[model samples]
Target: MRLVLRVGGLLIAICLVVACADATGVPGASGADVIFSDGFVPGQMGNWVIEGDNAGQTAVINEQLVFELADNNIMQFSTLPDVTFDNFILEVDAQLLEGDLGSSYGVLFRMQDSTRFYRFEITGDGLFMVERRDGESGWTRFVDRWTETPAIQQGLGSTNQLRVEALGTNISLYVNDELVHQFNDATYSSGTIALDAGTFVQPQAKVAFDNVVVRRP
Candidate 1:
C-alpha cells in the first residue's frame, strides 16, 4: 500500500510546494484552552492543504472537509501547516458518506515531517488501530492488527467522534467518547496534526470531517 503525506503545507506526491493561507480558530468550549478550532466552513480552511486528482481528492464542501479516495492501497491526508503541539486533546466528527466497508480513516498527530508520525484510525467495520511511521525505517503497529471494538459505529454513513489525548510519551485514543486504547511512545514529542482517509484493495471512499477542536488536556 502507498501512503501519501502532505508535508510542509503541500501535497508531496509530486514534491510541489504550494502557498497556504493562515488558519483562524473559532472559540472552543467554555474554560478550555482551545488552540485550534474549525467548523470547515467554505473559507475557514486556512493552512489546511486541499488537493486532488483522478486518484482522489481533499476538499471543503457544504461546511465540511471531505476526502475521496478513488484508488486502492493508497492513503490521502491533509494537515494544518502553521501550528504545532506537544500535548493536546483533539476531537473531530468523521463519517463515511459512501465507500467500501474495508476503508479506513482517522487522525494523524505529532507529525515530525513527511517521514514520521502517529496514526489513530478506524475502519468502516468497527475496528480500530494505532500505528507509527518512522520514515524509511518502516512502520510499527502498537496493536497486532485491526482490533474490534464496540466503541466504533459500524458501517457507512455512521458518524464517529474520534478523540486523541497526547501528553509527553503518553497517548490515549477514544471513539464515541469511550476509551478504546492507550499507550506510550517517545518517538515524537512535538509536531503538527493531520486528518486522513484511506482504502485497502477497494476504493471509492468518501469521508467527511467536521467540528475539529484542539485544546489543552
Candidate 2:
C-alpha cells in the first residue's frame, strides 16, 4: 500500500508539470514572438535614435526613454525613419510618470510626416481621443473622444497598453482591453508610427513606454 501511494503522488507531480508546460506554451499570454525588443541595455543603441529638441528625455537605467517627470513625458522618435505599412497590428505600453492637470501622451500611426498622422492619445484623467490630420490642419478633428467612467488613472508612472490594428483602410484602437475607436480612411493606406507627448498645466509630465510590438498582417 505504501508503494502504491508513492507512485500515485509521483504521477500527480508529473501531471502538474505537464500542465504548466502546456500553459506556458500558449501564445499571446505567456510570451510573444518578440520581433523587436529593447531593455535599453547600454551599447545597444542602433535600432533606435532620439530626435527633436526635447530636454529631460533620455534613456533610463532600464533602457527605456524616460521623459522628465515634469515635462509631461513627451518623447518622440529619434532614430526610426518613417515607413509605410500595408496591413499590420501595432502594440505599445505607455505610462504617465507624473499626472499633471492636463497631461497626455499617445502613439501615432499612418504618420506621413511630422505634421500628419492618426493620433490615438490618453490622458491622466482617463480621457482618450482619436484624430486625423489632413495637410496643415493640425489634427483636423477628433474621430472619437470620450471620458472613461471610473477614470482609469493607473497612477503616476504607471504603464497602460495601447494597440492599433490596420487592415487596408480599416483601423481600430484598443486601450486596456477596451475597444475605444474604429474608423475607415482610404486616403492613406499606410505610413509610419510615432510617440507623442503634450503639455498641460505647469507641473509638466513624463511618459515611459515598453513592449512595443508590430506584427504584419
Candidate 3:
C-alpha cells in the first residue's frame, strides 16, 4: 500500500510540473522570448496609445483588445521610439472578434510616418494583403488578394499567426505555419513596427499578441 501511494504521488508531481511548463512556455513560433505582454488591466497604459478614427469605439473586453460592433471599426497605435530593426523576425497571434464578418486587421512595418509604411493585413474574410502607404502615393495595393483563407470567411475567435522578417529589402510572411506572402520593397529600409486595426462597420474585432520576439541579425 505504501508503494502505491508513493507511485501515485510521483505521478501527481510530474503532472503538476508539466502543467506549469505548458502554461509558462512561449505561446507562439519557437525560439522567441516575450518582451512586452499586456493583460489590459486598467491604468496599465504605457508604451501604447489608442488612436485612429475608431479609437473611442474600441475597448478592452475580458482583457483583450476589442473593437465594438459599430460602423467604421477603426483602431490605431502611436507609441514613440519606433521599433526599428535592420534584420529581425516578429510574430503575433490575433483573433478577430465574432460579428466581424467583413473586417480586417494586421501588422504594420517600416512605419516611418502616417503616410509612409507597409501594412500586412488579414481580412475578416480570411484574405491577406500587403499595402504600401507612401508619401507620394496613397494606400497603394502592393498585393491585395487571398493567400491564406478565402474572403468573407469567419476568422474571429480563430487564432492566426502573422510573421514578418526584414533582411535588406526582403520581406516574408507566414500564417498559421504556412508561408503565404513575400515581397521585396526598397521604399523604406528601417522604421518602426506596429499593429494596425482596420476600418469596418459593426464588425467586432479583438487581437491578442503573444510571443513577440525580436532577433537581431
Which candidate wins on TM-score? Answer: 1
Task: Pick out the ten consecutive residues of candidate 2 with the lowest summed lDDT.
Answer: 12-21
lDDT (Cα, tens digit) per residue for candidate 2, span 1-217: 0001111012100000000001111124223533333434446433454423333343444655555533322333322343455577877777887657356677777867554567777777677767776654434444533455233455676667888888988988888767877788786677777666555434456677665566665
TM-score of the candidate numbered 1?
Answer: 0.88
Using lDDT as the measure, name the better of candidate 1 and candidate 3.
1
Model 3, position 168, has a per-residue lDDT of 90
Q: Which stretches of candidate 2 lie over 4 Å from their true place?
A: 1-39, 43-45, 51-56, 69-79, 99-101, 144-146, 149-153
Worst lDDT run of 10 residues, candidate 1, spans 10-19
Mark the regions of model 1 whose C-alpha exceeds 4 Å error after superposition. Answer: 1-32, 44-47
- Candidate 1 CA-lDDT value: 0.79
Candidate ordering by TM-score (highest first): 1, 2, 3
Which order, best to worst by lDDT?
1, 2, 3
> Which is the winner by TM-score between candidate 2 and candidate 3?
2
Using TM-score as the measure, name the better of candidate 1 and candidate 3: 1
Candidate 1's residue-wise lDDT over 48-114, tens digit each? 5567788888778887888887876667777766678999999999998898987888998998875
The segments of candidate 3 whose C-alpha lies over 4 angstroms from its true place after superposition are 1-46, 51-63, 73-75, 78-80, 144-153, 201-208
